[model samples]
Target: MKKTLTVLIAAGALLGAAGCSATPQLTNEETCARVKTVVSAQSATSDKAGMTRVANQLRPIKAAASEDLRDPLQTIIEYFDEAAKPTPDTAKLEDMKADYSAAGQTYGQVCGTGQ
Candidate 1:
């Protein structure tokens, strides 16, 4: 009974880890920006492992961002030579910002600056 219970607990932990590892959708700009930030942070930090820890902590922030190609009005005109399409669910952007901020806090806790 003790062995069976331990196995069940271990299996549950593995399943939970697998489920948590699923990647959230992110926008192209967000991905690029985050990658750039991580790379820059890596270069600036002396501890490679520590920098990696910080980057990993911030992954969800980048994942939570969207890349649906919506831009501010002027930037949209500059890129597509027309107005950018309006997003129906703009609140997600705010959520993404909050996620990023939380990630920043996590990074700061772990890496001292969170970049």
Candidate 2:
């Protein structure tokens, strides 16, 4: 019984250590590179499917992003998500365009991109 308890405690300690060793937060440069890759890959596609794809691809990147990068990434993701809907509202799309552009501008500035 004592041996079993000792083994169990050892296993629990191992698991606790593993749980505490989480993935490090992405650096701004790494996040920027990933965003650039996804955006560049999806840039040519303007259809609903493409928009959805872009949003989906960005979701994880945004989720893992640093605080400073989150808002612009979210804005871009939202724009793509809304654009992907069937019969997206034209006026709404127009309204979102400015924000989208600004977000893109923010991303470029933050990421040091020529985009």
TM-score winner: 2
Task: Name every residue pair that clashes in candidate 2.
Answer: none
Off by over 4 Å in 1: 26-61, 66-115
Ten-residue stretch with the least lDDT total in model 2: 42-51
lDDT of each: 0.47, 0.85
Model 1 Cα lDDT, one tens digit per residue, 1-115 = 9999999999999999999996776655554465447557644353544544544544455446444322221121222211122432355444455554554454344334445
Worst 10 residues of 1 by lDDT: 73-82
RMSD of each: 14.5, 3.0
lDDT of 1: 0.47
- Assess the local accuracy of residue 104 in candidate 2 as a C-alpha lDDT between 0 and 100: 90
| Candidate 2 lDDT over residue span 1-115, tens digit each | 9999999999999999999886567888989988878878936378888778888888889888877788999998888887888878889889999999998998888898777
